[model samples]
Target: MEKAKAFLDKLTEEEHERVSRLPFKNDFKFYEDFALLGMHVDLVKPGLVSCSFKVPPRLTDGNGNLASGAIANLVDEVGAAVIYVEGLPMNVSVDMSMSYLSTAKLHDELEITSRLLGRKGGYSGTLVLIKNKTTGEVIAEGRHSLFGKPASKM
Candidate 1:
């Protein structure tokens, strides 16, 4: 609570502006439903980042179950946000793989955590895990490979 607020407050003005420029930042519907679901960002370092999000109804699929695509998108967004937050040039997802470990029903809050794994040349990799908030059950996992390049290249 207090610690989280302090961390957010500690961000430099430039960093704050960069994050605010994120595509989803101005989306009220996204914020009201999906983005506000226990989202947190921890900047580990340049080219390194960690982020998590709690699953919510808006992120569920037609069956009222956690949507795999939505989980993948969340992981992708967080991973990219890390690079953007570092004031580095933009990067694009070159490849991504998501594996569902379990199903989350409506109203079941789950946390998805992502971390940078490694990088080589113009390629960066990340690993993400989604877990049930209360039971610590793994609901899904993802691996992402991104192509690093200047923002102008995008």
Candidate 2:
């Protein structure tokens, strides 16, 4: 519509840059890698995944604490990784429940653990917990639900 087009035309140069839209043709890069930057996998096994990371300023909320959005992305990514099956497409998030218990400041080491609660057909449930490595204080907890299509017989 003309009205919508006019509204889009009114976007400022800075606004356009901040929008983060990218061409989807080829050689695309993920925009959210900063959320998982410096993460180190400490352990992995059936039904469980554990990792550690140090909070970086790029992931902060400008108040010296990790941003809530970054925490949610971690829950989604790590949570899905816990239940991943070989030769199948990646699981897609169905729902997420998050509880932010405390804040994590820059350079604070974080311990993240994800456990598979269960799986039925293509639906899976996972629990992700993030804690401060030094104090062992809970930073956030997430219950994530995901669905992945079963691999077909060739």
Tens-digit lDDT string for candidate 1 (28-87): 555433545566664456655555455666778899987877777777776665555345
Cα deviation of 72 in candidate 2 (Å)?
0.5
Give the alpha carbon lDDT tens digit for every residue of 1-154 in model 2.
9998888788899887765564232443455454565899999999999999999888899799999998998899899999988888898999999999999999999999999999888899999999999999999999999999965656
Model number with the top TM-score: 2
Residue 114, candidate 2: how far off, in angstroms?
0.1
- Let me know the TM-score candidate 1 reaches against the reference structure: 0.64
lDDT of each: 0.71, 0.90
* Consecutive 10-residue window with the lowest summed lDDT within model 2: 22-31
CA displacement after TM-score superposition, residue 61 of candidate 1 (Å): 1.7
User: How well does model 2 score by local distance difference test?
Assistant: 0.90
Clashes of 2: 0
